[model samples]
Target chain A: MLIELQGIVKDYRLGLEIVHALNGIDIRIDQNEYVAIMGPSGSGKSTLMNLIGCLDTPTEGTYFLNGSNVSHMDDDQLAEIRNREIGFVFQNFNLLPRASALHNVELPLIYNGTPASQRRDLAEEALIKVGLKDRMGHRPNELSGGQRQRVAVARALVNKPSIILADEPTGNLDTRTGDEIMDLFEDLHDGGNTIILVTHEEYIAEHSDRIIRLRDGRVERDESN
Target chain B: MQFRESVFIALDVIRNHKMRSFLTLLGVIIGVMSIIGMQSLIEGFQKNIRHQMEQLGASVFQVQKFPVQFGQQDREKYRNRKDLTWDHARVIEQYCTAVAQVGPEAWQWGIMAKYRDRRTGPANHLAGGVPAFFPNNGYFIEAGRALSDTDIQHNRQVAVIGQDILEKLFPYENPIGEHIIVDGRRYQVIGTLEKSGSAFGESQDNRIVIPLSTFLKFYGQNRSLNITVLAASPELMDTAIEQVIGVLRAVRKVPPGEPNDFEIFSSESLIETFDNMTRAVRIGAIVIVSFALLVAGIGIMNIMLVSIRERKREIGIRMAIGARRRDILFQFLVEAVFLSEIGGILGILAGVGIGQLVALVSPVPASIPVFTIVLGFVFCSLVGLVFGVYPAAKASGLDPIESLRYE
Candidate 1:
């Protein structure tokens, strides 16, 4: 098992009121699993994704990532885990708008304290993986949305994290562009990388190897394709 | 984060908003400029005043009945002093071994001295003193000879003319043997003084000197005689003054432990009193200027917070991509310090320019203090750090997920 959650509960205080964002969640995933977390607005699916990526800690219960207790780590330790073990891709691509594609791809390696010479080599190889070897010097603003997402994917894979966590990764693209992104993720999965995605569209969820449906901050159904 | 990466972020931000950075730095520039400029002018004033005080001589102290008024005073009140006598001055010189020389001076109240009917007085006064008078009291003869004991005892009516008196009385003629009329009394001009300039912080080269006996005969014992004593060395000046007081006590037969009715003053004491007065003024100026600096610091803090707020999504992306919380904090902090340091450097340079300008226009030359230069930059950096803390913390403390979701 690569990730395990034992009845994790997350509560939010919204100005004098307790709003339960995630109530008692239990789930498990093994290596190379392609899982899609599907839900409506306010379903707490995004919250679960954030927890899985270690961007946040659970308010209660325990989460185990690679047999290490994820819920007990301090912010710096969590940050270190996120930098070297988890890669994130967002709907907006979230590439530094002013940064060249090469620098954007170099972000993960830079935070991992990689030496400059190795940083350049790995960042270039990652960009080549996304088919953007020639667009390395172009800033996000100068690139097409598809090109920007490719740059973001390169950035996500640069550190070769244990799992790739993407939130609404294709929500901003056209159908054809979204298909291209899905095809890229399919290739990453075939290469033995575990990928977890959060999305609202069933068509996007249908393409994953496994589907985890969430409703009202609880897991409604978990099934393997 | 590596310092190299943090600096890159700072440099990019500065380059992206060049106009805003310059505008923000303007307040700092003016603030530093004013502080350094004012301090330099004050520093220059201190040096100039100190030099003038030193020219008053190392060992001389003067005794006067009342404070020496720089402005005009009523002649009636000045002539009413009956306590200070020439007898006291002579006895002090005769009995006090610590006193190297004691000279007494008495001057005509309002005499217009003249030569060849080109009259010059109403503005001029006639003073009389002993011969050790010249050097001990900060005077030097330009030509001819000073007064001798023969002139005082026989009332020979010999005179020594100062620079102004020499100019007024003789004009183009040699004043050594000339006779100048003082208060309608004819006296042979035996000596002319070199331009002694402003000694004891006053123009001393503008008065006339005659024999003390000649002065007493004309003006009587009504005017207070000013007694000046020179100690053997500057270190012993205090001891010399105590010894003079003892002699004066015995000479006047005053009761022991009784406060002397006369006052003694030296260049050091006079300067201390002057500095005390200006200290209050300098403190007040500093207080007023601090208010401007406070406003400038607030401007820096407020803008930094605004910058951090606008860059929330950028910060989240950086963190998600791999930047640690400290990396985010370091980047913002370095940016703020860089802004303030640049401002401080420019301000200090501006201040030096203003200081030089003031020095050129002022009565004295400017002597800038090095401590102010170092202090100005250090103070500005401190301002950056103190004010930069909250915003940098805000940048670091941001929740990555929510920050990414923020519109």
Candidate 2:
């Protein structure tokens, strides 16, 4: 197993009351798996994605990434794990507005202490992989919405992590552009890379080979497509 | 992350927000400007004063009836003291073993010099001194001869003029062997002294020197005399001063256990006095500049906080892209330091320009101290680091999930 979550429970303090965001959840994902986590609003899908991406530690549980228990890790340790093993794709296409697409792709390598000459080559390769070779010099504001999302995808792929965790990657795109991004993801999956996607739309989840549906912080269904 | 990467990012952000960055740097600019500009001026003024004191000759001291006054003093006490005379100079020259030479001098200011048809303005000073005055007062004969012992003993009506008198009275012809009238008295010019520059905006080379015997015959015998004494060598200056003081007290009949009723000063003493007088001004300037830097530092903190608030989502994106907390912190700190360093360089340039400008238009000399430049650079960076901490920490401590979701 590349990732294993055992009895994860997350709670939030909303004003004076405690809300259970994730309640006693357990899941397993192996290497090279294409999985989708689906849920309605306020169903803990985003919370689960945060844990899987190492953006947050589990409030109560054991999270094993490559057989290493990361639930007890501190912030700096989790940041290192995120840098080495997990890549994130946000719904809003979170790219640095002032940086070029190539520079944006280079950011991950920069944090991982890659040499400058090698970092540039890797970022260029990642941009070419995302079919943005001609638009590598464009900034986020100068690119179209689909192209911006492509840049975000390139950034996620630059470090060659164990899994790319994308949250509603097409939430802001039109149907045609959204389908184009999904096709790119299909090509990536065919290339034998692990992918975990979080989405609310049934059509979006249908692209994945396995689906786990969550409701009110609990898994309602788990099935292989 | 590499420091170069943080600096490049900082440059990009500053370029993107040109107006905001300039506004944020204004306080630092002004703070550093005042510090360098004021210090340069003060240093120039001090150098000019020291140069003037040095012109009084090396290892030489003087005795006068009144002390050099700073602010307030008892005027009646100084006025009641006996006037120093040539007799005191004679006694010190005879009794003091460490004294090499004694030159007695008396002067009257605002006297006019007339030659043929040319007349100088009524700002010329007339002085009476023996031949020893030339070496003791740092004056060298540029043309012809200075006053001789025979000229003083025989009371000859001869004068050695300064460069200003030579220029004003004898612009077209030689001043040597020509007679000039001063206060209805005629004296033949025997020589001209070298051009000694002015001090504190007053011309030093605008005077006429005559024999002391002739000066006493014409002016009167009641005027006070200033006695100039040169030590045997530079190393003997302290012993020379002590011997002269003892001889003066004995000649003036100063009682035991009582203070001498005269003042003695030297070039070193004058420099020391100037330092003491300007100490308060230096401290006051530093206090004011420090306050300016304090306020400037506060301004930087406020702006850094605002910048962090505006870029919360950007910080979140960086954090999401695998930036550690320390990486984020270092990035913001570098940006702040870059801003202040730029301000420091600009201020130093402006200060040097101002110093040179003042030197150009006035008599005060200007000099740029390398230490001050380095100090300014270090101080500005320190201010940036101190002020940048809170905002950078706030940025790094932000929750990645919440920051990503920030609207």
lDDT (0-100) at residue B356 of candidate 1?
Answer: 92
Chain A TM-score for each of the predictions: 0.98, 0.98
Best by lDDT: 2
Give Cα distance to truth, residue A106, candidate 1, Å.
Answer: 4.8
Off by over 4 Å in 1: A13-26, A32-34, A96-144, A174-192, A201-211, A218-225, B1-34, B67-85, B106-129, B141-222, B250-255, B286-296, B322-343
Whole-model lDDT, model 2? 0.89
Please write out the lDDT profile of model 1 over residues B1-407, one tens digit for every residue: 57777778777887898888878777788888888887787777677667766877879998877654433565455444446788888888887778888888886655787787798757666788888677677778889998888888887788998887777778798888788787778899999887866532345677788888888887786667888899988888999899887887777677888667566778887777667766787777667656766777788888889888888999999888767888888888888887888889999988988889876765445667689889888888887887788899999999988898888
Per-residue alpha-carbon lDDT of model 2 for B1-407, expressed as tens digits?
A: 57998899878877888888788778777777777777787777778878977877668999999887733568877888999998889888898999999999999899999999999999999999999899898899999999999999999999999999999899989989999999999999999999989876678899899999899899999978898999999899999999998988888899989998899999988778777767877788768877887788888888888888889999888888888999999999998888778878888888788878888898777788577778888998998899889888999999999998887
lDDT of 1 at B338: 78
